[model samples]
Target: METVAQRQIHSLLAKYGESHLNHTNELIHFICIPAIVFSFLGMIWALHPLAAIAVTVVSLLYYFRLSVPFALGMLLMSGAMLWMLSVLSQDQVLKVSLAVFVVAWIGQFIGHKIEGKKPSFFDDLRFLLIGPLFVLSFLYRRFHIAY
Candidate 1:
């Protein structure tokens, strides 16, 4: 019996074609996204500590249907972003990280566009939270963590 997270991921893979994501490539995304968000936050007014907290809470609240594994991944990544931004230099790290995130998300958009399917999250915002977790699921499997 598939769990709800399993079902959602399955639906996405079915629509997008499993070929859309190479396992290693997706894991790279899992690692990189938080770094990008961290860097981007340093350069933006809305990226204050309070706002970051709000983003995490709001996104997680929207992710109830997802799963423990998926939720854990989100918490981990968001925490990582907060740490990286706090430690790194705003002028240098922020610019580079922002660029990387923009490029990666663009790739994601392109992937969905090629599938001729709108992003699942666009249908319901919680799926936006699922996008990164879908990437981390590969890492979880690689480590035998049971995501």
Candidate 2:
């Protein structure tokens, strides 16, 4: 029997997939989603490292409630992003993050234009968080890993 949490994850992924059926859009998302995430985190890190850590902790807790594998993946990903941010000078973090955030969003919009569908997040804000999971789902499938 499918657990309620499993059902919820399935339903969310299926609904999110509706607008992402276009191959071009999926390809675009494959690149842009991670870029957006990293840049977004970089922005928060720019404000204060502790603020970024707090956000990551909160997000990981939510992901853990949904799926352990996903939470673990995000934990690793978040750590890597934080490490990269640490490599940059304090002044550069905000500037680089803002630039990447703007460009990635533009790419996302262009992808949606090609897709002829509005972003899933426009209908439901949770889809913003789900977007990363959606991308990770593909990796999970490719590796025969169950989430």
Candidate 3:
């Protein structure tokens, strides 16, 4: 029997997937989503490392409530992003993050244009967070991992 949490995740993923049916859009998302997440975190890190850490922690807590597997995946991904941010000088981090963030969002919009549908987040803000899990769930399926 699917637990309440599992059902909720399933429903959210299904809703998020509705607008992402185009192959080109899916491909664009596969690249741009991670870039957006990383650059977003990088920007926060530039402001203050602790702020970025707190964001990650809070995001992980949200993910954990939805799905432990996804939470773990995000934990690893966020850790790697944080480590990469540490490699940059504080000044450079903001510049690079700003550039990437702008470009990635542009790519996302273009993908949506090709998809002929507005992003799911426009309907509901929580879909913003759901987007990452929607992408990660693909990898989980490929590895035959239950999420």
C-alpha positional error of residue 128 in candidate 3 after TM-score superposition, expressed in Å:
0.9
Q: Give stretches of model 3 more than 4 Å off.
A: none
- In model 2, residue pairs whose N, Cα or C atoms come closer than 3 Å (at least 3 residues apart or on different chains), thus clashing, are none
Worst 10 residues of 2 by lDDT: 1-10
- Cα lDDT tens digits for candidate 1, 1-147: 898777876676444334334554444445554544554554441345566677667766655455666677777877776676666664565466667667767765665555555556565664544556666666787899764
**Which is the better candidate, 1 or 3, if ranked by TM-score?**
3
TM-score of every prediction relative to native: 0.62, 0.98, 0.98
Q: Model 1 misses residue 119 by how many Å?
A: 5.9
lDDT over C-alpha atoms for residue 129 of model 3 = 93
Query: Which lDDT value does model 3 have at 111?
Result: 98
Q: How much lDDT does each candidate structure score?
A: 0.59, 0.93, 0.95
Question: Candidate 3, overall lDDT?
Answer: 0.95
TM-score of 1: 0.62
Q: How many steric clashes does model 2 contain?
A: 0
Choose 2 or 3, whichever is better by lDDT. 3
Off by over 4 Å in 2: none
